[model samples]
Target chain A: MPGEHSSKQYDTDLETIRSKVLAMGGLVENQFQDAISCFRTGNVAQAEQVIKADENVNNLEVSLDDACSHLIVKRQPAANDLRTVMATIKVITDLERIGDESTKIARAAKSITERGVTTINHYETIRVMSISASNMLHDALDAFARLDGKQAIRLIAQDELVDHEFRSIMRTLITFMMEDPRTISGALDTLWVAKAIERIGDHAKNIAEYVIYIVEGKDIRHTDYAASQLEDRTTN
Target chain B: MPGEHSSKQYDTDLETIRSKVLAMGGLVENQFQDAISCFRTGNVAQAEQVIKADENVNNLEVSLDDACSHLIVKRQPAANDLRTVMATIKVITDLERIGDESTKIARAAKSITERGVTTINHYETIRVMSISASNMLHDALDAFARLDGKQAIRLIAQDELVDHEFRSIMRTLITFMMEDPRTISGALDTLWVAKAIERIGDHAKNIAEYVIYIVEGKDIRHTDYAASQLEDRTTN
Candidate 1:
């Protein structure tokens, strides 16, 4: 139980840190949702709000890094608790990257607002995709908090749906661009937003992998780490 | 110096890993160059060649990772050696991603070839941008191998030029799309290739930062870890 004592201490620090990371994750999720809303309703003000909030998101990421470093040094955690700490570190990196992608989308949204591009069919599809992606992000973080491997595994499977939707939306946008020369700039802007949402899905999947790692103490990055682990346990 | 034995072990292991990474780096550089060559010349066979070569590039990355891990365990290298191993791990990751981006560009090229989208402009700009980006990747690796902080720092500064060229190429492509709706799909394809090139530049910059970290024993990721280290050395 030597590792368990360290686990309890690390878990206390990890729980505190996870809350902060989730707060940042929530901010980034809001940014993606609002940026899409900005494009849909021509709410330039909402886009501007999203842009302004980026600095706070970035500041939170830096603070989270600082806190993680201090906790690692103090706790020197191991095993499942160690995986949780590592997961928090990596999840924040992915979440911070998601924030950057949101900022990129917000920038594109601003440009489209300035150009006064009319709403197109693809924009609505993008909005729907963003909602689904945001939901995945929420579920992934919840799975992380609860250490729910089943939920995490389910969320990983759902990521493919987001990718499929994104490709379909890209097809529609490209088709619109092909039919009208005037839609070119706006189409590119929409493409950027879609790409951002797709990346958000990637982050959500990364979080899900972390949940699996925490629950199973296995690496699931490249290989079918999760499936193999499940198979091993059943065989045992 | 007691450090020299560890340094020699690190140096030998580092040299072995460096050569392989640079080889992989060279392969990616060629992929971008060949991908665009396929585009401009409508070389379907060459596009296929680039696509096929990606597997070798990916395999080299795996080899590089194995080499790095092996060295870390064998040498048990401290601070500077540790930094070099860490740098190798990260640089290879970047190289692998660059390979992925290059493969995407190659796929776009093949698609363009299959669809017979013959109208291509701005080839001169794209060529120049790709070559410059290719050179940046080389320079970044060279900087890391020599531990040349000044050269690494210079490469970081020059990343802006890649951005400039990429933006110009994008603007030109958009203009083409605006002039003729028929050009929209081709323009979108070209835009992704340009984005891929830009990301390679970004990865190169990341390698440069790692070079700074190893040379100065500082963390230059977000904070000015190098600048503070320089100030400390000066004061001492």
Candidate 2:
């Protein structure tokens, strides 16, 4: 009776934790969107909202951590189940960091708005990069929810595109800086936002790696594209 | 007899894991040093060495992961012993990421060196920032080795210095861009190096958090300067 009772309780607890992780992920995703929108249109109020709402994201991280430890101590779930829980714990951390990056962007946006610095020609590149990175986030989370390795792999491939956009943005900023030194502050702020978007892309890649780990028990970390090619050749 | 044999094996395995973590820490420290040197003088050979030596760091990470899993499964170490092993597992990931950041710096240095870019004046700032970040790494790892929350707390406080330095560097780059748009490419490279160093400071802060977790039953992830305040409160 004790065994049966405890097993049921663990199942319920895990479901709750999963729901909470998803909720936190949604909150983080929204924060990114809000933060980017504020930067795009110079919406100071929206940027302020993003900065103020960071506490919610921070609190979610703590709760998620507590749930992870409780599950580990109580259920001691094994293999794929263990991997899933571990992935949840790790992704929550990446999400929390993403939240922080978004806050950084929002703060930058607020500063730019207050200074009445409206000559933002390079932000178009930042906007495009933001959208691309956001798509990576969506795909990574979708893969996680479905436990699909192929989707995760595709998401990882998208990361390079974001990197390209980030580099182009840097080039544009450099050009701007060369034109007028007074534009330096705005350019640097744009650089921070671009960097934030790049970090979001990195976190997306991290989630994709976890997806592969959970699905295939493959430690794809530090592994090159050639490893897969070699595996394909050997199997064939 | 099984219990006695298990105890001896556990002790041996734990000792091996401890040694492996220290070795990994040493490799990471070396990479950071080489990366800074590469940045300082465009040392392409040194940068290549740092890049090529990344494999050793990866190997250490995998070995540590395997050892942690094996120990947890076999010994089922409880309380402080379990916390110690978990901390080791967690800190290695942070160390490996630090190594990755160093690689990034090396790459940036090599790229600029390839372009034969000059006229950068913030070289001193970059040097100072790298040293400050490396010092933070040393302090954080020392705190881990000694399980000293007080030391970890102080090391994390020092992260603010790195942040402040990064801001000043950004301002310098902005000024360069504003004065002459032609200086954009070199300034961007400089910005990337500054960012890589700031990221190292962040990883050091993360290691400090892990150390605090190991020494005290606390989660200081989202808490504001909680680790530093802990010692003062306890003393009073």
Candidate 3:
């Protein structure tokens, strides 16, 4: 049977992987916020910056994956330690995808800005959705860093709000498109921005779920919402 | 100091995990095809079936993951064997998400069918996109089963075709929505179906990339399309 390495080097390696994940998470959060700002200000330049910065996030993911693999091979951690490494591997994938979604939002912002179309009324809804999603991402990373399952559970509840806001924005945009055919292209781009934000929320939820799995050794994914809610209440 | 296990049990265990992944892939492909047929026939019941079948995919993913963890702990596989197991874990995630995407498409189809809207002219485009995506999923599974890196590289090139078809369908749907405001809701649903189909193609490409990684021990993901195409030509 494989035994966990009793060396300080193994612990340091694990900590390094965790720290890298947090740094990557921080970069993704910044990218997401920048993408939202680009949407609000119609700043194609800022959007371009966000798009350009995604390469760093991608590099970070590769390095983190390598770190995790090396740790697994060298240390042969078992049980909870192994779970942490596995969860880190999974979490980085979500973080990298979140960065990709931010880039998509940035690209949509650039497209809409170049079209010179004012978002007008729907801007507020998009703004609300973006803020909620960004906050969820921030909090999820915090929970991961702290290994706080309770905080992660609370973050899971927030995805519903982000999703609701996304649907609300979609409805308003659809109405705007129907009222004026000229707005269809810009409105579709706005819809895509909202969709991207909503997906970020989903990735955040995935992270939160991973946090719970790492902390509690429970597999709560795809569980019914009511059951999850009950578990949240009971656990907390 | 870990030596490769030369035991038949180790080989059987690896074979079992591969079979499970292939079974999961088969289920996801069926779900995608069923979702498309539901769209074509406007059968809400069939769409519901697709949605309901997703639980099986989720279960398969969990079992496959657990089996992988057990294999890692018991066999302590190294080198290419370790990469194969790691790739299997990642591939199952993509397959499960593909099943989820199929469920999303089925849900969209149900909503559109309930609206009593016939897809009419757009049906052919959506059908073509779905078939291409389904074919990619099939080929990707075959590549994984055979450990055929060259075939997987060829499969990666096919994603470009699926993407092009997705864009064409989107443009047609956008035009349809703009021409008649009444089609906005249904057209939006159709756009979502096309988007889900596009995502399935993406997940298939991910599986193919994993196959190459397993066979060649090289990380080719996040590389540019031109580079991947050149790799495809050179590798084959």
Candidate 4:
């Protein structure tokens, strides 16, 4: 009770920062999903919308960064509080990057649409990868909001599956380009889309790592996924 | 003189952190250059060396972050000092990313070497782009070290040239893949290498922006480059 009373304003400041991060996360998730939908349905307008909405993500990042700086200056937060603020700063960066990846996907979708190449069958793998990556982003944010290290670890493991899917799709696209040179343009666009989704998965995994760092005060970044998985299991 | 005496230790701590960041930047620049060399010469051993050197970059980043955190906790640096530390933190992230991009280029070089495709004629453009980008990175780090906002602004303008080279390389690679399907795999590897180099340019640009922020207390990030250029000209 003594600690709670002493730190009311600090807690409120942290909460405000957290809410802003979550709001930004929600918008990034929507941007990613809409980008994928545009790619799947060839909706040029929706792709343009996704590109335009990136400004909001950018604005939120700037504001959140400013708020974090103010909090650190005013509060001089220590230990866990400092880690929490640092994690928020890092998380917003990954979120903003995810937004950029979404923009890349949307731009690729628009280019493919403009090229008048509507061969939809080749995109099944990309669609699946997009959904998986988006879900990872959603759950990564959930884990962060809940401060659930275990859930974050699980999301980190999921990155391998996304990577595997990406490799498989890349191979398939290469083969398609070799079989018929005419498919090169469309296949290249699909390849960019897949790369964007893979990058999004990477950003999501980075967020999960930040969550673990926040909750456990452990810097688990740069460690191999399999090694971290072993550590996660042994600890739990 | 009283203010200087009071903050002597704080200034020393900041200098130590800045030196670590410069060391890390030097290593990253070497890694990027070596990776490019590996690709141009098809030297798998050099490619492996570049990949191995990335561990040092990663270690440096961890120690630098720890040092920054310790300084923040102990000194509670305010205003310009706070901005300097924040910019250092952000710059190190970009430096670490440059290392990662170098690793990607090295890996791509190894793959291309394995493919036994030593068509060096097509790599002239990539070679020029790599040199340009490497120079930009070197200058950007020098600007950061000097806290020269004008030099940083100039580096930001140079990013446009790197981007133009990247797009031109992409178009040429695509054309090569379309003309000769047999070159598709090698072309893809080269594409990844080019993309990695382009991303390094972006990271360098990000560092320059951070330098400007540290010196001018202006948040020029995420702003239009042309607008910033105009501002830079008028201010000078």
Best by DockQ: 4
* Root-mean-square deviation (CA) per prediction: 5.0, 4.1, 2.9, 2.5
Question: Model 1: how far is B98 from its true place, Å?
Answer: 1.3
Ranking by lDDT: 4, 3, 2, 1
Q: How many pairs in model 1 have backbone atoms within 3 A of each other, for residues 3 or more apart or on separate chains, i.e. clashes?
A: 0
Q: How much is A54 displaced in model 2, in angstroms?
A: 2.0
If both were scored by lDDT, which would come out higher, candidate 2 or candidate 4?
Answer: 4
Local accuracy of candidate 2 as per-residue lDDT tens digits, B1-236: 12433367777888788777878888899999999888888888999999988988987887677677667656755554666666677788899999999999889889888888866745686878888999999998788777788888888888889999999888877676666677778888888889989999999998898888877867687677654496677799
Per-residue lDDT of A190 in model 3: 83
Q: Give the higher-TM-score candidate: 1 or 3.
A: 3
TM-score of chain A in every predicted structure: 0.89, 0.90, 0.92, 0.93
Candidate 4 lDDT at A202 equals 97
Scored by TM-score, the top model is: 4
Query: TM-score per candidate, in order?
Result: 0.81, 0.90, 0.94, 0.95
In candidate 3, how many Å is residue A78 off? 1.2
Better model by lDDT, 1 or 2?
Answer: 2
**Which runs of model 1 end up more than 4 angstroms from their true locations?**
A1-17, A60-88, A118-122, A222-236, B1-27, B45-49, B52-89, B217-236
Judge candidate 2 at residue B86 and give its lDDT: 62
Name model 4 segments beyond 4 Å from true.
A1-6, A119-121, A225-236, B1-6, B119-122, B225-236
Better of 1 and 3 by DockQ: 3
Q: Which CAPRI quality tier does the interface of model 3 achieve?
A: medium
DockQ of every candidate structure: 0.31, 0.45, 0.61, 0.73
Please state the CAPRI-style docking class of candidate 2: acceptable
lDDT per residue for candidate 1 within A42-117, as digits (tens), equals 6778878988898788778667866765665466544435456656766876787787787788788778778766
